[model samples]
Target: MKKLFYLLSFLILTACGDDKFSPGIPDIGIPEVEQPKDVDSVPVVEVPEVPEVDIPDPVIPESEEPEPYRPTRKIGKTYTFDLVEDSGIDQTKAIQDVLDKAENGYIDKNGDTIVNVIQFPEGKYWTEGFDVGLKKKYVIGLLNKEFIDIEASGATLYTKAPGHPYGGDIGKGRYSHRRHFWIENSKFIEIQGLRIEGSNTIQGDLLGTTKAYTPDFWKAGGLDRGAHGDVPAYASYLEFEHGYAVNESQNITFDNCSVYGVWGDGFYLGNKVSEGGSRNIKILNSVVDFVGRQGFAASVADGVIIDNCEFKRVRRAPIDFEPYGATGYVNNVRLTNTYLEGFHGGIAALGRGQVNNIYIENVKINSPGPDISCWDSAGKTVRENWHVKNLSRVRSYGSHVGSIRFKKTNNITIENSFVPIAKSQSKKSMELTDCENVTITGNDFTNGLYIISENSSVTAKGNTPKQEIIIE
Candidate 1:
């Protein structure tokens, strides 16, 4: 009876929402009820008090020391100029004046003209790019002993409106007549320590009411005047949005430079109209950012090296060896330790041209589209001899897109890569069609099925998730 009386009294007190309730107990109030006749003799109960616990305030340390200042690389002869005081066009003319007055163009033992050193100080000089010729457009020469040295001391050169005239069309046999940093048929041109800005402007008015593409009749040599046709024979041209165009040049180097905000490719190295093809070229510690097309596009080249470069936000591929014309044969190209992000395709060599001895190692790819893609549109036995290793894909979207693709190529190898798959990525990680002698080894395809091949010349060894190899 006493226990029952105590239980009823406890319930009644808890229902009253009294401040006397213990911390651990819920303060639920109870409605008034008729008292039982024998409830007067109930004993009161008390909850043990929780010991007053204390928590100390958190301690925050002082801010970390500032990172050590690293200096930029210094090379070649250095000069100073003020861009804020002059218009971009005037600044270009000023730099050209310096180039002209620095040294007279001289002929070397190889019968090539040489233009000596030109260095611009740290400033943002805005203008269209420049054209460096041996003597005339058709003249042939070798750049002798550092023939043209341009050192930009942490400076930026931008292309503004009414920029240089159109240089030429990309793959097709067209001509823009205007030039944008058109370094023609020469050698030993070393440019370094600069950033190029295209400002995303096409500058179509630079044509000045002239048509971009020549009529078919004009191209057939039927539009000849009393002399010769005033129009270039092949007259289709891309817009003036190129950052650098190295045409039929050899032994050229671009070091510690950057290109950004261009409507077209950042770099175009081609041999469409040149007397000779490009050879022994290197692009080192460079960056291509925010370009509309390929970051670095080359055609008809040999012994090209791209090392320690970063490509960001290029709408197309980061690196492409594209042969749009018959003269396009890319050979002996190496890309090492390069990083690419935010591109449709990471790397590609496309066309019906001979591409050989291409090596890509230590490449990181994270893009919205295919990380690596190669296609032979012409369907000939054109692409060959490619070796790629140490590829890493940091992120993966769903399975609709592929990480790697090869179509109509032969003798390719991809090894030592990390391809992590998520549930969202249901598509195959690799796609190979009409490829021959493909070797895949030492790779991690644990999260996703590896390859979906159409034609079987596929060899696979030493890949993880071995039991789950899906061959469709």
Candidate 2:
């Protein structure tokens, strides 16, 4: 029984000795399962599936936004003179303001701002005068070049009287010897449909007399003493009151305008000999009446054209190409379809200055003096190339001698004209003195005589009445 008990203990010890049943050793073959510790543990969580959505961006305020860009230069603009602003008073300041604004244009998306067009309303505007264009240089390499158009249809610019105080000279109460419209050192200016009226009493018939010649009146207004002669007295009194005075300008045009009761010429184109002269000036469809001097006059100019114009009651000739300076000249002038009446002379191109290439076509003159006169002064003889065609209705008044006269000229041609006999005078239709290459043809000189003297060459043919040609 002791042997059986030992064997059983040995068997138990042997079973305990196996590594699979040991306390510190783990089983290698079979996996162990984990069991839950508590019943209140966290439940299983299932994530929900969300649908896709579109969201918009946030908006910004206008104050925080950026502006679009703009260019620097701009094109020419048109400005109209405010009738309300420039009314019932001296319109010099208001008119000048508009001119200045137009001259200095605004900038925008267009081209360079250089040209401007100014328009005025229909009314009577009293002014002292207006001066425009650059008179001196500003910067180096900068030219006084700008284009301006003045559209003054149905507008009248009335000048201050001789005794009235000039606007430029307020305290002095003197008449300034300034033009009504003075344009100098400019290019490409056009003035349209403007009427200019001045306050001069001397008309055609009252030239040499003391009709309105107030010597103390003019002297108190800062005018020089007039000369002794009748015409010179009145002429020197108000010599600078021209309707329009242009100096050293180019490509200027005056269209559909009228000048009445001006003290000086209707238009005066002059330039200093040191500077370049005026060029390409044109006056078309205009009228000049009751002026103290010539209708159109130039001292040193080229390419002047006067077409479809009428001049009446002028103190001097209707058109005068007489340059006053020694080195001055008038060249390349054309007068077409013009009428001259009630004047001292029709057209005169005589001075110490040189005159060349004048053409007159379809000109009708009814005056008391010579119809057309082309001559040189006593010592100097440089006038040449005068042509007159289709000149008719030439009626002289008060026993004036010759209807057409030429002296000391060269290359003259007078054709297709009509001249009536002087009834109470010498009955001379045409006269030539010291001329060269003169041609008189196709004219109606019935009961009229041709007096030729010291002419080098003359051709007279195709004339009516077959009058006798006298050569002296």
Candidate 3:
């Protein structure tokens, strides 16, 4: 609904009369008459044929690019719920009404149990000391975080207690059990525009993996301190639409959303080194800002994609790939249109993956340390292959490693990237070691020596055709 829609009406105001005013060959004097007098006034002046006006291209505001895979329109029968329904829901009964409408044999006017669009009407609704539980259920709807606010005592969604099988362990882990909204074992779930604030977790990660960086958390390459589970256990397989999980658990998506001001990460999608791990995840159009630890993190996962996301003021790597104590390998991951600003702590992307096939492109990172990392390994077992393009980094602090480091990595290639590092950060800009099938081509290294290799040589000589770099 745009303003000033009535202006278009004037375009259709060319009414006409037949024989009443049809001037024939009028002279320079005032035109005798014409069906359209306005046309007669200028036509004697040999008015050039009017040209059709070209409509301007519609303005496309900066927005989150939607994944083409999702069903653009609603999927199922549209179900609408209001805290102020016929049920007359007040503060005490708002959450209860929503829950009762979601579950408990509530159907729409068309007898459709599967609600596709459960909407919260536009209003400021409050719930005091209310508990919303999603023990194991598939809910599909846009939870508007802009409109809903949950108190400290009220839970948006909870899976299980600490010791229960539902691993939402915040204390024993990191972001466990603190479920403002929990989804697991629940596939094809879409939650959008939901804000989860001022919540606490008992034992888990926000997305579904157990808490990490604590003593018990162990995957493959040993993360010293393991964390707990953020959400409850058994809540696997979810698809977040536009939800925000702050200081919650793992195994969730923050698509077109933001997560901030938490004890943990904006979105930490990975199991600890001790556990198996989380997998097949995607986080796009999201922001992980002002948190304690990493932003858009993936510790023990496979097939992850974080695209068009932003991270600001995070403790650890803004876009981290920490696979501690991994077993098989971490593979087929990507991050595009992603930007990381601020060095709450270390590397922008701390990729310690097992195998290869980890790619990053179109990334702009500003940090106190290195931008890309493939360092830290216990043995010569796995070779993580990465392909990076259109990457830009502004380094302010780093010393032990290079901006584009590859220690336990192999089969990696970075092309058309700009790495401008401060000498104070490190005397070196790039380092390669113990890697095979490596190539660095057409990279703009503005500071420090452009290259560093250990027992390696260029595969081909002076091949700017595409700028290939090889480090054996």
Q: Which candidate leads in lDDT? A: 2
lDDT by residue for model 1 (1-472), tens: 9989777777887788785853445647887797767876776688899998888888898899997655432333434454553442535656555554543234555544545566677877655433332122211122322456778867786654222233443456443333335566667778888787753422222212124323333334343121111111111233334567777788899999888766566777776635557788999999987665678888778899999999877666788887756556888999899998654557877775777788989998876667676776677655777898998887764456557778877898989888666667764667888788989888876566657787748888888755233555
Candidate 2 residue spans exceeding 4 A from truth = 1-75, 83-88, 104-114, 129-145, 163-176, 201-235, 397-400
- Per-residue accuracy of model 3 over 173-273 as CA lDDT, tens digit each: 42233323333322233444443322122222422222422223322323212222222111211111112332112233445555544444566554444
Q: Pick out the ten consecutive residues of candidate 3 with the lowest summed lDDT.
A: 233-242
**Range of the 10 consecutive residues with the lowest summed lDDT in candidate 2:** 133-142
The candidates, ranked best first by lDDT, are 2, 1, 3
Task: Tell me the number of clashing residue pairs for each predicted model.
Answer: 7, 0, 84
- Cα RMSDs of all predictions? 24.1, 18.3, 23.3
Compared with the true structure, all predictions reach lDDT values of 0.65, 0.70, 0.48
